[model samples]
Target chain A: MTKPLSPGATIGILGGGQLGRMLSVAASRLGLHVHIYEPAANPPASETADRITTAPYEDHDALTAFAKDCDVITYEFENIPTEALDLLEQHRPIRPCREALRISQDRLTEKGWLADLGLQVAPFADIKDAASLDTALERIGAPAILKTRRFGYDGKGQARINAPEDAADALASLNGAPAILEGFVSFTREISVIAARGLDGRVACFDPGENVHREGILRTTTVPATIPHSLATDAVLMASRILTALDYVGVMGVELFVTDTGLVVNEIAPRVHNSGHWTQNGCQIDQFEQHIRAVAGWPLGDGKRHSDVEMENLIGEDMDRLAQIAAEPGAALHLYGKAETRPGRKMGHVNRLR
Target chain B: MTKPLSPGATIGILGGGQLGRMLSVAASRLGLHVHIYEPAANPPASETADRITTAPYEDHDALTAFAKDCDVITYEFENIPTEALDLLEQHRPIRPCREALRISQDRLTEKGWLADLGLQVAPFADIKDAASLDTALERIGAPAILKTRRFGYDGKGQARINAPEDAADALASLNGAPAILEGFVSFTREISVIAARGLDGRVACFDPGENVHREGILRTTTVPATIPHSLATDAVLMASRILTALDYVGVMGVELFVTDTGLVVNEIAPRVHNSGHWTQNGCQIDQFEQHIRAVAGWPLGDGKRHSDVEMENLIGEDMDRLAQIAAEPGAALHLYGKAETRPGRKMGHVNRLR
Candidate 1:
């Protein structure tokens, strides 16, 4: 991994969702071919990837073949099976490293790790059972969120507590799995910074994008966020600290809560995040390409924004407006090739250049 | 052909070169898939295309199968064999139509067609043999270029006649094939306009880019060409006239010679051209996407340039500068995945934003 990958090298991607789809396109742009490993047939990324292995993550044969063909391995989602990653890493280097994944995959570990860096995160308590849930609720406060320590995203495996009376029901819903109760932070808005740390340890960060979520799903991300310039600089510094701490290589998405006092990190994704999609239209090099460059051990591109952009997610039925969106001037539509339109599914997104 | 192609429809691209590779990427961005038909195995576009048919154009069965899978067919190059196109059009529609290909494939027909339209083309004569070559040299005079009537590109299949004595050698260099002799125009600069005409006959043109050539191969394309505003307007109008006359349905590149009196029509490419590569970084919707939209019957995306950009081609050993170029701020690199590099071969290109 000391030398940059030559053009025509194969990059192995563990997931074949839209992020992987975009990643494949970016890899192709750099003359790097991608081999996608996903269980579903004709996954979104299969359309652009050079090769695809349709097998479950637990299948050792498929994993071995995929690893054997790749110059380097990366994953689109952080929730990849630990056993699968351990196997892949034995054959080829897994970028952003296994340490980043281990921390970001579990809520308790992620929160504790961030807090250890003297960073401001919401106050939280770990709960393993009903008795612990009551104690944690008492310590964290009544208005809190109880989330499973692992495999929780988009409001799944999460329940809100209005008071102590809800603790029993929340613990029962978790079925005694390890969880964390986080007291809600009073914040003005939510924003995310997408930064890439190259193999050379140099970090480049795009302008933080202000985010709006509807029903716990990201709705829109607007650049030139309402945050003051000073606050924006602080956000970038905090993100750099996280990247440095992880000894990270490749793009990482850091979500922050803008409060009256300062910015508080909510969470961090070890791969490309939805909020950074605006960069595809707003910058010379996009987040996907930034991630690819970092993973390929190439120099990180300049992550400077060149124009104002607003990105709106076309979730599920929202894709029905495809024609209308296409007809809109300056709107760049990116639709994932998913056949079914299940509610809340991120079918695609559109970046409108202003 | 009347209705706009629905998202997820497959676009059949005729060639598997860099243009087709980029066209596949653009088609994927719009939720459409691309099936590339290429005679060579592991062609550049094969990395990103959803499907690829690897067989010579003479294989009628392969062409039929490719057309059957695609909703609409478009080509990356103009010289696709007529027999293959004839078979493809039977199963699917070929956009930019057969007329554009028929006229553009032959230098004699293309020049005749342009001159008949009351356009300003260079003084020219058709040379069918050595006798015709001598007669054409006498009429067009020395200081002319003798080019094969078909399949000449990147300065190949061409010879220059400096004086009357050089006419025989120039015609001999063409191997007695049908040729054309054209007197060189005294122009200040070479510029190209990339335009698209939709199914409904609506046309959108990008600002012209000034071109610089090295050994007759394009080296760089700089947007905001050093031309008067009125002349730029005329360039767009001239491009529109060509598209209208052809009843074209796809992107076309119209190369022009900016002279003291007016612009002269140099040539026309019925697909995405090298000079338009700058739009990839300078505009929200690029020439590749515009071509896909025109063929898919979707409304064209905005073609207006938002940033000043200089696009330089990475030909042959120019790829040795990948590290240095990738490190440059605001430079976006695009590499064609060709395993071997040869002099005059287009390996990739870089678009630097100013």
Candidate 2:
């Protein structure tokens, strides 16, 4: 087996958002330096990172230098530029692999990939043009989501097809970008599996957590999701299967819809997911550290939950209640050092132990 | 009461060792910035700190600039130059107070202060010259330790007088430094309480941890010390008395000797201590964060222990078994990104939950 990264080695992280910020902290705990590569001048992750390359992804010189300095490379976001990643690939290996990123970058590709792997995915149809949209609408019907194949996140880049009459308007909203129509599924709750795979190919999954969304943003994730024991096992097995199939070497957040029949795959994040933030307070090894371990070629840690936690995101005005939130007895607050608190902006999160 | 420091305000930390490194990280988690003012270039704390001022404490310009930039100032170590502290104090307030620093900086001073509080302390006598050493030795007797009054740590600046014959040699070992003769206590065990005092004068103490020392260096600190519940309460009460007497703002590590009679205060650290490192994995709010909260004028967080933990320091050669330690189940490893490993140099620590 390849040797795990020695202490003092650098881990290059693409994208310097909250995920990268948390990942940098985890890497610091493991004696690893993080070089955050982000276009923004002073992104949230830059504060704690050893150094930050405030250059655009298209900058070949910056990408090459960052990769050369790092022993291993990992991205906090899946939407990193292909050219930058290709240049970095020449210097250091990227964890979660380019294949995982490529598949997850496109909604159509991800849905098809999951279906091909014999997984129960949401009913999705690719809409290449008006004719394709019409044909898909005929097959899938209305009350679907018209999401852009690329660059969709936090309920952005998506349009709701509430009725067949709204199809034209929904398509128009995407500005003619390549899209996919996902037929709605009646599910009792949404749960997510934060799974990790070490370089040695051992897949481990944290217990699934039920999620709540407000205004298209994740509000809270409660661990010990009130699902049947068998469904939790199925969710973990499904996540494990996907990770193994992708040959994933880092943490992936698999979102699932708990229907009457079984768990249906909703989406997967090829990096530490927001839903898994509860693990920071609930488990010995949080998702950030788990991702860092996998990418560093270290043995995966036992992520057994020691506490039941409900993680609530502090979006925008939610931070106004900071004093009261700070006084909450069992709350573990993690604030991203963001300069501004714009509406819907994620300022921080508090994991309240239940 | 003064208003609490805002989330984005900077907290200047003096001395960039592991404690500063951890405190910097905790500050980041609270959305606060840390400017680590350390003389050592590329110190472990600098990696995680937002910025580092690598100038000697004697540099007035550097110290002044650091203080001007930070809303509040704190330190990871005692014994900072008085001139530097005076300059910083002109611009910003130093938490835990200079009084606490002064008392803890000198072994003799600390012992006297503890005794003045009506807390049980080991017999200690100030030794200025040869005559004082002889007179103190006559009272405290043989088998005592000759410790430097100031600037000693990890067995440094201290020599043991095991017998009457060794007394001369031990005194000579100190090289004319102001010393203290501490009579050895026949204690069954040593335990430490990590205590905090907020700006609001609220006090909270973590469960006392039984400490084991090897070569005068802390080896392990296990929570739930093998002491009666009564002694634990007494230990907390004693620590509370010390904090209250000092009007201390921030966390302090109070080492105690658990004898047959009761708990005796061995010493106190003005900042977070190695014996309390297990709180990182065991408690809702660790000593570092607790210290930050106190100094920042925020309400003290709940210091309740959620898990039983044993923290072992990885000193020098102890790092050789890193692979084994990393593989151990329920182990949470925290490595200080120090480049070289020398004898007795603290490289990292591991917290293993039982």
Candidate 3:
């Protein structure tokens, strides 16, 4: 195992969105400084981070300089450009490794990797062109979802096909980008496990949280998920297996489908996830801090849930409810300092203890 | 009632020490920015604060610039120069108000104010010169403590008067500074209530934590103090009374001597106290966050402890035990990011949940 980072060491983060903002706060809590490298000026994380480089990822010199100052590099988003990662790795190590990103960035590759690990995943077929789309639709059948191969998030770059007649429009929705057709699985509910793997390959998983979504954006994640104990154990074990296989050394959020058969792997996020926000109030250590500890090569904290919690996202105009939320007892409100509140934009969240 | 500050507003903090560093982190958590003003270069708070002004309090231009950038000004230490406070109050509002500082800055004045508020405090006398010191010693009797009125902290500027033979030397040790002689009280244990008073005159108090001091410095603060339930209620009520009398607008740490008779007010810190560090892991809202909320004119959170916690201060060499402490299950380590660790300096603290 690599040596653990000292308290004063700097952790360089790639993206400076809400996840990076929360990660920076967590690093500061442990006496570590975070240097955020973001393209946009005055990013959300810039206010709290120790240093910020407002340069695009295309600027290798800036990336090199950022890496030179940091002991280790990690990221909040998974879609970092390959050239940028290549330049950053020359100066410092990146946690969760490039392989985890390689698999998670593509729907086909992620499903294939999970299937190769003997885990159940939705049936998927890669589509390169119109003919491939027809063949994939024929095999996957109707009521399937077609997603772009990369750079997709928060319901973007996705088109659902309800019947064979909708295949062409679904393929057109990709705009000639590579796509994957996934056969929809009949599931009772969606759940996620926020898990971590330490530098020593030690694994820890928080209790699964049941997820509820509106317009494809996550709305709430409640702990003590209705899943039975035996299934929870299986879910944790499956997540641990994925981490060990990738040699991952940071937190990952594994979204799963609870079907009549068993748990089905839906997707994996290489950094802290929205589904794990409740851990901030429900457990001793939160997912953001757990990710910081893992990337810093420190021992993983005990991921035991101490209380029942319900975390609700405050998207866009939902921030108008701040007055009511703040008035609620035992509710912890977290607001991202974004200047604009456009439609569908995540403004903040509230974690209420039960 | 004062208007609550918006999320993007800036909070100016004096004294860029650990308290300020933690306060900056708390402010950032609530989507607020902090501008730290300190004389020292690269003070601990600079690593977390949004902006840092490395100028002495004598730099009126720098102080004016800082106040211009902040919506409201608060402080981490009480020993700020009177001239600096006078200049700052002219530009922006200071939380806890100047009256609280005025009273707390002078030991004799603080004791008199407490006595006037119907709070029990140690018998004290103002000592202006050698003659007054002799007269105070005669009146207060032996085995009392002589302390400088303006700048004493952490047992500094203090001398013990065991008997009449030690009176002259003790008086000479003050270096001709104004002083206060306090009669010693035999007590069972030292306990402190961490309380907050919102802008609307509403108040909330966390449970009192028993404190243990070593060489006049706090070593440990354990919650669920061995005191009876009635005494705990008295401690909270007394702290609330003190806040009400001051018309305070932030968190205060009220230290008390728990005797067989009742609780005696020992001292009150106008800012977040070291004894309240346990709240970081014990409650939903911590002392730093509570202080920020109060100063921001937000509603006070439920200051309820959800878990039993023991916070041990990692002073100087105590940092060497971090490897063992980190390996301990459920121990949350919070380092202050101080570059140099000298004996008796507070480097960090650990909150262990039981």
Residue-level lDDT of model 2, residues A131-191, one tens digit each, is 8888888898888899999999999999998778888888999998999999998999999
**Docking class for candidate 3:** medium
Interface RMSD of each: 0.9, 0.9, 1.3
lDDT of 1 by residue, A257-350 (tens): 9998899999999999999999999999999999999999999987999999999999988988888999997898898988888999999999
lDDT of 2 by residue, B1-354 (tens): 268888999999999999999999999999999999998889999988998999998999989889999998999999898888889999999998999999999898899988988888889999888788888888989889999999999889999988867877888888888899999998999999999999999999999999999999999999989999999999999999999999999999999998877888999999999999999999878899999999999888878999999999999999999989877757899999999999999999999888
Q: What ranges in model 1 sit over 4 Å off? A: none
Q: What shift in Å separates residue A102 of candidate 1 from its native position after superposition?
A: 0.7
lDDT (C-alpha) at residue B90 in model 1 = 87
CA lDDT, every prediction?
Answer: 0.93, 0.92, 0.91
Cα lDDT tens digits, model 1, B1-354, are 689998879999999999999999999988888999999999999988889999999999898999999999999999899999989888999998999999999988999999999999999998887787788878888899999999999899999999988988888888878888999899999999999999989999999999999998999999999899999999999999999999999999999999987999999999999999999999999999999999999999758889999999999989888889988868999999999999889999999986
Of candidates 3 and 1, the better by lDDT: 1
Which 10-residue span in candidate 2 chain A carries the lowest summed lDDT? A323-332
Candidate 3: tens digits of C-alpha lDDT, residues B1-354: 278888899999999999999999889878788999999998889988889999999999999999999999999999999999999989999998999899888888999999999888998999888788788888889899999998888888999999978878988998888889999988999999999999999999999999999999999999989999999999989999999988999999999999777888999889999999999889888999999999998888989889999999999999888888877758888888888889999999999887
| A-chain TM-score of every model | 0.99, 0.99, 0.99
